[model samples]
Target chain A: MLRDFVKNIGYDDPLEICLSELEALLQYNYRISKRSAALLLLQEDPEMFELVRKNEAERAEKIFSIIEKIKPHYSYPLAYIISERRQREASRIAAAVTTVGKKGSLGIKEALSRAMMNPFIGGPILLAVMYYGLYKFVGNFGAGVVVDFLEDKVFDQHLNPVFIDVVNRFVPYPVLRDLIAGDYGILTLGFRYAFAIVLPIVATFFFAFAIIEDSGYLPRLAMLVDQIFKKIGLSGRAVIPLVLGLGCSTMATMVTRTLPTKRERIIATFLLALAIPCSAQMGVILALLESRPLGLIIWLSVIVGVFMIVGFLASKIMPGELPSFYMEIPPLRFPQPSNVLRKTWSRMKWYFLEVLPLFMLASVLIWVGKITGVFGFLVRLLEHPVRWIGLPSESAVAFLFGFFRRDYGAAGLYDLKTQGLLNGNQLVVACVTLTLFLPCIAQLLMNIKERGMRVGVAMSVFILFFSFGTGWLVYVALNLLGLNL
Target chain B: MVQYDKDDKKQVVPLSELKPGEKGQIAYLQAKGKNQMQKLLSIGVIPGMSVLLVQRFPSYVFKLGHTQFAVDKELASSIHVKPVK
Candidate 1:
């Protein structure tokens, strides 16, 4: 049956002649038939070419020569021509085997799917999803309520004091005690931040994202945004990584590998690093600006404006082929509870495993920096720029923390806000600057790993200056407008 | 309605020109690169297959067999089709 099937699916005359000629020359044993191997070689399958070269040795050159000879027969690539022929055969078989039925009228699901692709309707739908899914569920509940409860009630009330008391009694050295249980200790600061604050916010975000993905709404959202994305040198396929960036930019940076072009990956990476704040940072910012609506609006406007302008400028500066968009639009379906839970749990576990150690390491690094006076020096250096951006010099600590982890920095700002240190204008400027700040150390390493070192370091340098410059502009603009929040 | 040439019976136009609900048979792909051609072919967009334009706004969406796909205007324009009236 296999032999007959293989023979029946022969290509056009010129390709067939070349395939047979190449097949006759191939002496090596392969898992697939020589005909299929010959076809792959003709279509320029690099893996097959390598295998044939390794296995066939001297005969490989002859086989390649036959493949080269067949090239001028068609204007299109052999792969495309072969695929077109196969499709024609497949359609013929499909038409012969299947019976056609009368088309049915549009159902409620179909209408809803259409409405989702409609710009006017989809715009409101997207806003509603973000407002409910991100703002209310992740921000208010996860970051606000859950974080507060865990940090204040659980960790502070029960865990930290017990750990601190036990460490002080058992540990002999003051420095060791500080390292293990004091203010910037692994137990008190690192573990607390990871489990109490970042965990809940990230968990809620993953849960919400899982539901959105399972419902098959992302492709529709991508379709609606393709036109706008093209203006920034990205195709709608980039929406996946960009949305995932909201959950965790480090993970999103890795996801940029799915993009078709280097240019798209670089642009997406830049945007994720620069403008798209992770859920943890966003939740803290939302909480910080909750009281001052005008401050929140200004921060939002500034961040969004920076996102577009930077993306547009990057597209023009980077030279490459424009990204082309193509994606399957799966039917929208109700998300299954079990699937959502499983996805959310797996992502949370992956994130926690990747991040917890880094948080602990950050705590140790901060401790080292404090003892060595490096942290103080860096904070003093950051203070100049912080002051330059019209922020109080004290907020420099948060900017330093921003390098360790983007959310850690935002959480630092949250502490400042609680102490009533930042006024409305200052709060907005800080938020805007911090949101546009460099990606966390983890994402920076990922950027380097995924893109080459030169591009990654280049982007980081650009962001360092651009973020502060944008923040300074926002400060001047806000003051020039003379509108008090 | 089918479009016709003065010299021939069938007139070919880029698939992007088709309005929603119009039907066409793909004539050929004028893809500029091997990557684009591979992507289109992997999705089963090939000569002789019937295509139905489902939506043309924000992006171009079309149906091939039972599956639906969305492509940007650049990709859509590369697909030359003959209208099926």
Candidate 2:
């Protein structure tokens, strides 16, 4: 194979021949290739050293000594020198085998790639996408419309009452009825939250995300955000986790494994735990401020501001230089509708399965806590922080619930919003605090899985204090400004 | 760049597969590069970049030169070859 591409060897250096021989030696044993073997020889591969040594005891020993003698003269670790040559051969062949024409893909694709990468212009375009793709389409259309039909019209109004009656009549025991079909019933809160709240919003998000991912919009997004993210010591790779964080921070935490350094991972994980909120939280927030544009601006500004500021501070504290950012930008393809739909469906299925169990488990835990009075005890403990932030005592329950899952807290807030229990200022503080709260159990588990328990616990404590601290500041500032919703 | 490995252990293998505090030889590289060979020859990846799969996972960790990269499997596939050392 190396011979076929060998148009010319420039010079049959002894090292090259030795490597070729080495490759053959390895191949006789059913190995991959010899050229690769030879390259590894030049690189002075430690593993292959034993294999080569055993192949030709005296000569291999002699060659090893010579390699050691000559190794330092070359700046490249021998491995790179070999790979570079192969790459050259590949290039030479590619030049011979392929040709490019003046014409290529154009119109929308090229224009979109450019637009998505440019920061100044791209920022607003991003916001527009957020507004439509996220706020209007997902929040209003999916969660608001689809969810209402499934949760309220179909389940709550029509199905729940029927199920309740059937369970009550069939099950004579009150305690058993409560467990299966009553207030703490799995069929009620668990299924309702999963189907109604989480499903619709996630379905829409996956739809939008698939389109963006397939179109190659994500890398461009990384390019656009590189500067801002760089200030925080993350390169474009951080963008993947950060962007995915919007969909599900737990998943994003796992994806952070793609980043380059322990330092960067720590920083990314910290920022994620503290700042990035998932799709459901984003949607609920948007809906909370949907009728109030100014309020939305304040919320966005605050979150972004905190993101930048905290990121800056963390990068400074962590010991490592910013990694150079480079990512393979796959050619932008028109996002196929079917691909988008399939991706959305698959992700929704994953999200639903993951969340449904957690929701049911959470309901059971809550039920037990309620029965045991532990729920009130925990809520009371949470209320002190709630009061410190100037939110109503009821908001403590949401904060307490936030520990179970971040979105669950948002759902609790949504229930409160219906009762008009919060104002613009209070809402802003609540949103900021909840958004910055320690990541849910899943993300915490991911943090432990990826970064280990020490970093995970440290991150959790940092987030808890930081979130409440931020909330306290926001609450004080709002009051100082005398702006009341 | 070198051609991708045709073997079973595709570049998609997690970086955690690499041993800690160990080095591997660059057996090959396959990328669509013309000057890439020259560039690699210059850098020494020409079958001898001293391919060290450093600090795997938490970042596709690699340490070379005065630099380090958290390389993903996507990048690894572009530069093929068996680990020799």
Clashes of 1: 0
Q: What's the TM-score of chain A alone for every prediction?
A: 0.95, 0.89
Q: In model 1 chain A, where is the ten-residue run with the lowest total lDDT?
A: A1-10
Over A1-485, each residue of candidate 1 has an lDDT whose tens digit, in order, gives 23323445867688778888988998888888988888888778889999988988788788888788888987778887888778867776777668998969988888999999998999999999999999999989999999999999999999999999999899999999999898779999889989998999999999999999999999999999998988788989999999999999999999999999999999999999999999989989998998888888888888888888888988898899988999999998999999999999999999999889998999999999999999999999999999999988889999998899999899889888888899888898899999999999999999999998998999899889989999999899989999777
Residue A332, candidate 1: C-alpha displacement in angstroms: 1.1
| Best candidate (score: DockQ) | 1
Residue B29 lDDT in model 1?
82
- Lowest summed lDDT window (length 10), candidate 2 chain A: A21-30
Scored against the true structure, residue A452 in model 2 reaches a CA lDDT of 90
TM-score of each: 0.95, 0.78
| lDDT, model 2, position A356 | 82
> Per-residue lDDT tens digits of candidate 2, residues A1-485?
34567553432365555555454445334174556565656665566777777776566656566667655755545555455555556657766777866766657765675556555677888889877887788878976888778876988788889889999889999876777777657777666767778777888888988887898777666755665677788876788888888888887888888886788899988888888989878777776776778777877888999999999988888896455554544557889998999888888887777788887887788778877999989999989999999899999988876777788788888778889999888888899899999887777888888889998999899889989999999899888888775
The second chain of candidate 1 has a TM-score of 0.88
lDDT of 2: 0.72
